[model samples]
Target: MKRKLWLGAGLSAAASALAGIAAYAAHRLSGPTAALKRETLFAFTPFETGVDWEEVRFNSVDGLQIRAWWLGRPESKRVVIGCHGHRGRKDELLGIGSGLWRAGMNVLIFDFRGRGESDDSICSLAYHEVGDLHGAIKYVEARLPEAQIGVIGYSMGAAVSLLGSADQPAVKAVVADSSFAEMANLVDFALANRRLPPRPLRALADQITAQRYGYRFEAVRPIEALIRYGQRPLLVIHCTGDTVIPVVDAYDLYAAAQGPKELWIVEDMPHCGAYFADRPAYVKRVAEFFERYL
Candidate 1:
């Protein structure tokens, strides 16, 4: 009887340990997976070969050095700053940048910290990235004080733009694609999609980010920013088939935003592929929107 009781206790302890390991693994894998695959997305063979581009670097307010490219006609006065998504470098944005350049707009594309050539290996999503966007805007302002400025951001980049636009009044127009309404919602979606149990682990991740970054993950709400300061010409685009970040978040952002705002729901496109799926339509719609606003 004594031997049997000891065997049962050992089995119970082993089971508990296994369960803990599974939970930790699931949390790490699902919480914040990088969406961009550099080898898969950055092949330059398909794009225009001889486009004008100059490598540039600048300093952020926090002293982080950022690397980017300036594309299009060098003497063009109209400019649009394009912010790439989390895990994505500026190279992935060249397709859209090319279109904007053809439309007579100079384009600047850069990576957020930790993603591309930028300094630092930590990303606080948009909570810290907004500061980077502010730094980029300041860089543009110093060079083109009299030029009208527009911004286009994707996913995490979009959230950063929404938050940054609230603080910077010089931005003439804003475009966000497949953006999340809140950072916590993104965490929750990622967890659920991976079929991971999300009780203590999710809470722990939030706690860790807050303790390290001095801001709660839940507090980085882009919908709230839209409600408060989405006054300029805004274009919110999302795809119905965006499994990574739900389309509903874009709807929520559009509903909260006031003034000259429009929401475009692209059918059958996944995540940020709306532009690639229909290049002509995407360019036409975006160009028309910017023409009306900027």
Candidate 2:
């Protein structure tokens, strides 16, 4: 009887520990929710001037309403679809859009569903966000048929654009900035950075994501996507001081790409701040790259 009692107790303890790990993982993934709220609430504080902004909305394949802005000179022949990072809306992309616009490219900046004015409240990371990119691409193709299309995506948007471009042939060239190699790696990095146990958190996050989205986070590996669909020219820009997602991920992506690619690492710039860190250099490189490729 005592042996049986101990065995049951051990199983109970193991189950409780597993539950705890899962909870931690879910908490880490939940970080974006609050961040999104903060960004939306303070959306008007930044970008006081430059570029004309117009509110626009379109329907995603899943029927979600996506919100965006058409910035700069609408008559420009060269066009760029700018995808904002997680928790960021089209307004946040104004700085980059203005630069691209001044470089003589029309910029279309949009917010993914569940962000800004778009419908939905949950982000499936890039797994479902790719659909948003497809919708944006279709919009661009229909409206700007004669224009050469290019894409600039940051973080989560970068991952979606990369995957979406792999599926769509119209994307002439791509600029991916501060992107993660995979959703699982991003979660693991977050947990480790917070001084938490990574394995348990990752396992839990995988279970939760699969239960909620019907797919595994590992299945959305951007590095693998880059390797598989490296036929188009890619420009990878990363900041050496990025603490959220390591700069090494950008290098890994650059190295894994099979086709023509360029990697630019901005010294001491944090996260997506590379553009602001060296505006002139950023504009020059981006213009030169698209001029050559597109």
Candidate 3:
């Protein structure tokens, strides 16, 4: 009887420990992330790319202030919005924005809330950030009533673009680079990679995350969002060497998409490494995609 009691106690304690660890991980995942140093990562701006830009600010649906840069004029009628990835700032997208601007499209790059120059908020891992992207679309529509908008996003931004613009008719095309298909699968993969117990922990972490942030990990499914695109064009870009998000996700997204879609899988590049691999090719492909579709 004593040994049974001792074993029961040990099992209870172990379960409690696992639950605690899962809770901690959940908070860390949904918590505010430290912003990267913009100047260090991006040495140049729109000026260096020979485009004139304006500093702009808008508010998200939830009333969070969003800071952005508008490159090129509304007269272009075609606009491309650049969405940066996790912990990254608008500065990181200047290169892509400059390319789009040179391609004769107005470009808008903004910092997601809780990242840089935006209102501080809990990072719901692109769930709530969808509102931020919508705010950007509204800003574009207001600036250029005849604007045909396209979106190019990397990693989390890619996921946001998929979710945020699914029902938005203003966005004509999307280029999703290194986006995850589902948040739950991503959490499972992340926990497993860290050598943590994934079964119970995954569900528990999601529960805690939802309790804390009012959003569930399982609810953000970019794969399902693709079905809503209908006849709109989508370009899924991923690298075989991407470790942050499996290249399989790109394939999944492409398969799930119902409309006119294209998938480009590059070799020997990490997450979002395709741009750095060959800037000119990357720019040309994206610019041509927008020109053809938007």
Best by lDDT: 3
Q: How much does candidate 1 score in TM-score?
A: 0.84
Every model's TM-score: 0.84, 0.87, 0.93
Q: Which lDDT value does model 2 have at 48?
A: 62
Candidate with the greatest TM-score versus the true structure: 3
lDDT of 3 by residue, 36-55 (tens): 32333434556777788988
Q: Kindly report which residue stretches of model 1 are placed more than 4 angstroms away from their true locations once superposed.
A: 1-49, 212-214
Candidate structures ordered by TM-score, highest first: 3, 2, 1
Tell me model 2's lDDT, rounded to 2 decimals: 0.79
* Residues 174-205, model 1: lDDT tens digits: 89998999877777888778776555446766
* Distance from true location, Cα of 11 in model 3, Å: 2.1
Query: How should the candidates be ordered by lDDT, best one leading?
Result: 3, 2, 1
Candidate 2 collision pairs: none
- The candidate with the higher TM-score, 2 or 3, is 3
Compute the lDDT of residue 242 as modeled in candidate 2: 95
- Summing lDDT over every window of 10 consecutive residues in candidate 3, give the lowest-scoring window: 34-43
User: Model 2, range 1-294, lDDT digits (tens) per residue?
Assistant: 999999999999987876777665654453344445444665752246466666667778788889887665666667788888876777777777777877877778888876777876557677777888888888877877877888889988888778878867788899998989887888888878978778876887788767755568777898888765758999999999999899989988998888889999989989988888977788888878887777
lDDT of 1 at 249: 95
